[model samples]
Target: MSKRMNSGASQQFVIIGSGQAGGWAARTLREGGFEGRIVIVGEESHPPYERPPLSKAVLTAQKPAESCYLWSKEKLGELNIDAVQGNRATAIHRDRREVELADGSRVPYDRLLIATGARPRRLNCPGADLPGVHYLRTIEDSERIRGSLSKGGRLLVVGGGWIGLEVAASAVSMGVPVTLVEATDRLCGRSLPESLGRFFMDLHLRHGVDIQLNANLTRLEGNGRVERAVFGNGEAIEIATAVVGIGVVPNTELAADCGLPLENGIVVNESACTADPCIFAAGDVASQPSSWLNGRVRFESWKNAQDHGVLAASAMLGGDALTRDIPWFWSDQYDVNFQLLGVPSVGNQVYQKGDTSSGRFTQYFVQANRLTAVAAVNSPRDLRDAKRSMQNKSQFDTTGLVPVLTL
Candidate 1:
């Protein structure tokens, strides 16, 4: 148990995990009139940087790793943030109101925020730890994978999720022969509708990517390094390297050790407040309730991190701000820019306008005739209008909207 101590008014605001959420939280606190001291402790030596570009721009060498930084020393200094890099918060001593660092140092705080992000979910096959096995969760990982691409060998992408598909697209663009494998029956089975999944399949097929669905991996057979992958059906494919982009597991060990309530992630209400009054959580680690869906959901997106940080900071400052914003995520594959608004349900009626084969279309998902969600591919204009209609809770009228949308 931690020592109990009274918190003084002069105590500083401490934030653990200096990713987008932590960076934005520190900045938002200053903007929200927090005049006391602020300290941001980060495990990574590098200052806050964006992770979305790691899979695309960074892997393609189009953007350098430094280009993704979220803040400069001057910017953080201007905001009065004491940036402590290369330090990991080992434990949260709630009773003492202090966070213990890996280096045996402790930082006292009146208010503490945990934004420890997440790590890639790794597989446990025999050759899973081989030299060629790679996962993209950080800039360093991207750099390693990009270097491997330059070596020139057949690449095997395991997982058909967004990250896997994006990496596959980038590999294809580099003129690398790629083989993508997904355990599910279709690509993006967890997110996109069946029709959209087929559309994506067609798009990738046209690009020369050999996609295999409903295929399960038995093990990776290699000598010192990966040379081939064995499937469950006794089929083996010769490959030079492999990249896995299945999903991520939130960094909740510290929170769990502190006895914080967790369901999928650290439990928090819409206001981002944990069970402890002085402690709060945000970003991927916080599972917040959603009034739009009338349930709790955890969002792991760049926008969610930025928005949740601001909202969590406001709540920590004794403000009554709660976020009920619609969740949106986008992916860039080849030449198509795919965007999804709100969460798509299985039973929602899908309506398509424009031609999908031509790489320009807007998909409207209506629940009981009320516009609920929108998906667009290379059609930004329709996406904007569809978003407005969905937010306004307008009923979709095919006859009335045809003239305006050219349906």
Candidate 2:
């Protein structure tokens, strides 16, 4: 067993939360030649694993939990990291530079990385606590959902975001009937553009997934288990399993308890450094400055988490490396792979070419005649070229660029 240290021991590096960000930070620190005492504290019993697979592959039993690992326990131990898993960090005693765990043990550190990720937001409606009500976040959650989805059951998905859409696609592929409900008029309302959102709606519709927009859930009705859902319009639908993918709430209690100023997330600079010199943050729980968005933005994507983790580790080790990577995100629904490069804003002039109906199309969002972002549907090579163009700050020739991309 890894020895637990006292509160007032010599200052070393301590990472809270063993998610992607924390795992990468620890590895990056070692790679950057930091041979000091390192401690990783996690509330989850399992080691760090890829989270994007949870909604699709793992939830549908296409992949196993071991395949999602960023680093196995043996690998982490080989790196000489003292891992304390299955225990939650109760509080942060900033005055003493110590972190209090649920088991009354404390770990002191000179530098701390709060990679404590987010949790799924729960619905306040009635019957939400039923047996069939599930939320996807951890591997265990995905396992439970996979078991519930066996033999093709009727699933009521309550959200229109990436997770909900991905799960809907997975369930439909497994021959399950999925009815997705969203409170908004369009899917991915907060992320994708309205036109793109409608395109996705059509895509899902073509895949035989029932989608309901502008529909608010009043309550989930069941007999000791989630069996049906009631909408705001008094419409009811019978369902065997209910999965909530509304969104996630950042786990910022530890940071907040230490008096860290949080706006949307733990406020961090371009280098992922927090307000205190001894503390830093990264991944979904960090609201850091973005060169692409021209402001501070919090991105909840695998790319951001992994990249920011490296940047955070570099900053913690007295290296200068600000995250300049343009935000990129991808989603797989049925046969289509949707990829987006750069930040898509409202003012961009939308340009379209090729057959979107055939699922081979790309949308170029140009702001002031300069390509700001590009959305691709099953067009990987074109998306790569578009990303390279953005990296080079090249303006798009709307007349020929679109046709060339299609070629």
lDDT of 2 by residue, 92-134 (tens): 8988999999999999988899999899999899889999899
Q: Which regions in candidate 2 have their CA more than 4 angstroms from the true location?
A: 1-11, 401-407
- Candidate 1 accuracy as lDDT: 0.85
Model 2: how far is 71 from its true place, Å? 2.0
Name the lDDT of candidate 2: 0.86
lDDT of 1 at 32: 73
Clashes of 1: 0
| Candidate 1 residue lDDT tens string, 141-161 | 999998888888999999988
Give per-model TM-scores. 0.94, 0.94
Q: In angstroms, what RMSD does candidate 2 have relative to the true structure?
A: 4.5
Residue pairs with clashing backbones, model 2: none
For all candidates, the clash counts are: 0, 0
Task: Report the lDDT of model 2 for residue 174.
Answer: 84
